[model samples]
Target: MRFDIPLPDDTARLEALAHLDGLVKPVGSLGRVEELAAWLAAAHGSMPPRPLDDVRVVVFAGDHGVSDPAGPHGAVSAYPREVTASMVRVFLAGTSGVTVLARQVGARVRVLDIAVDGELADVPAEVTAHKIRRGSGSIDVTDALAPGEAERALAAGMAVADAEIDAGADLLIPGDMGIGNSTVAATLVAAVLGLPAEDVVGTGTGVNEAGRARKVAAVRAALARTADRASDPLSTFTALGSACAAATAGFVLRAAERRTPVLLDGVFSCAAALVCAELAPEAPRWWLAGHRSTEPSQAFALKALGLTPLLDLGLRLGEGSGAVQAVPLLRSAQAVISEMGLLADLA
Candidate 1:
């Protein structure tokens, strides 16, 4: 509740726009580039908007018990449950797409083992155990977490944000690495937006026809269990969302509280962004949609958040890879804002 959210400052926005008008070009030649510069100014509540030079991508890795459990459990992912931990190790080893992308963006990567099912053995120093639990309860059958699990997960995320900000990370990207998380995000989107599960569910991780059908059913069940209270952030998160979702929500909330901008990645972080929106209402002031995930619910999440993503290359990989891909654009937005000369100066 202490998101202590900042309001978008029109004065800062106007100041940025004024500067943009002075630049050496047609008044609006840069188009959305000018709009983005103003938004950065508004988000920071500063006229010149501090540069996003220290972008950090923090990925919350967890495992879900709802994953492709054997037999009657059905498949929520095309890959096995082992895939979550496998990808976490991949992230830790610096070979994952997100790791490679983060390097390309000149951003530091922090992979946290929040709640992977099996313990991550000998994780790198950059990877730490912020484990809220080994794995979340299956949402299709029952509440995915206990009454207080959402708060704990959220607190863990806030702590992560504080540490990163204290250490001088100016921009943050919150990513998720749980295999079955898209299902939960779909359920969250449906429940929060008051839509049918079918409207928000998507075939995550390239599931087959049968697997996609099973995923839809899981989302419906999870939404049914949530009932009302979708507007209640903690209750909604505990009932139908995963720990990684709650943690990502917390991370976003903390970033907004500190007025540090966030690049939210994919559907998983969208669900978390929804949680922050429900709780703080003004949190989106400090956030931007990094990409539109291939997940169907991601579109709904983006619409609900009123965010137009920076890219949409049909990215479905969710290790913060898509979000990191947009950092260069943020840098570009800053560059065009700060470096372009006035027409008089150009002459």
Candidate 2:
């Protein structure tokens, strides 16, 4: 689908900045929150950007077939593809951390079964199923997805974003739900940032010390497997990423095209942002780094994106729960920009 939203007007943004400077508080005292409002206005081509009343979170779940190897981490044999659907079921049941946090922030949560292999019979009505393939091909031996499949996954995500926008969703938070996703995330980060696997690999889902070592080794193997392939961003994604990664990248691009703000979660989300930046550089301006995850690779990805997260609660959850926690702060920033009294008015 083609999205053709116009860029924000420069003159209108300048005027909004001036008005912000004249607010009651000290200039720039509101920090990133004030900047966020100004950014919204700039994105909308208005003096004061309007708060998005319809906030929806899309959590794309997939399965990675590359977690079968037994290495220094003693082989994550229990991390099966079925775990992807199991956790997604938990998310749909509103029992996962992401569901709880989203509810607290007044944001609707929607789970997408992008490429899970098993049947999700008990999935809630709100959860969407867009299974592109049973599961991604094993990156340890070959590419994770076919080139055409990667593009289809991306388009699927864009279609979801379009539908959400059509339904009046002003803000979009595209998240991920998959076991062994960190391996893909690390590879994507390493590929896009031109870094080695060791630099971007980290233990995910509470892996022990040995498990962390094995995860890093798996990333190296995947990188080596795809070494002869082109270093193009899409190529890297199709080689090492899951459907969740491609979908998230598409969601980010669509959000930028519509001038909507996107709150990024942890490493998985950041990996998607890296792909989005490679595809559409301007999209990062529309993103807000919600928080820094406990994962080391998340920090590397955030730094690569030049985004300082609003919170540093040492969160490592991937269900977009970390991002949801920052909604209150964003709301407070909007309040400061639009509701705070002027000095003259107080006098």
Give the TM-score comparing model 2 with the true structure, all chains together. Answer: 0.92
Candidate 1, overall lDDT? 0.84
Span of 10 residues, lowest total lDDT, candidate 2: 69-78
Candidate 2 ranges beyond 4 A from true positions:
1-6, 69-80, 122-128
lDDT of 2 by residue, 9-86 (tens): 677668767777888888988777777777667776776667767789999988777765543334533366677878
For candidate 1, write residues 1-347 as lDDT tens digits: 64578777899899999999998888998888788889998887887778888999999988776784662448879888888888888877789999898998789988898878876777765565578888888888777788888999999999999999999988999988988988888888888888887778787888887888888888877776567543478888888887888899989999998888899999899888986799988898789999889888889889988999999989998878898998888778778887888777864
Angstrom error of the Cα, residue 98, model 2: value is: 0.8
Native-structure RMSD, model 2: 2.4
Q: Which stretches of candidate 1 lie over 4 Å from their true place?
A: 71-73, 124-128, 228-231
Best by TM-score: 1
Given candidate 2, what's the lDDT at residue 213? 78
Q: Count the backbone clashes (under 3 Å) in each candidate.
A: 0, 0
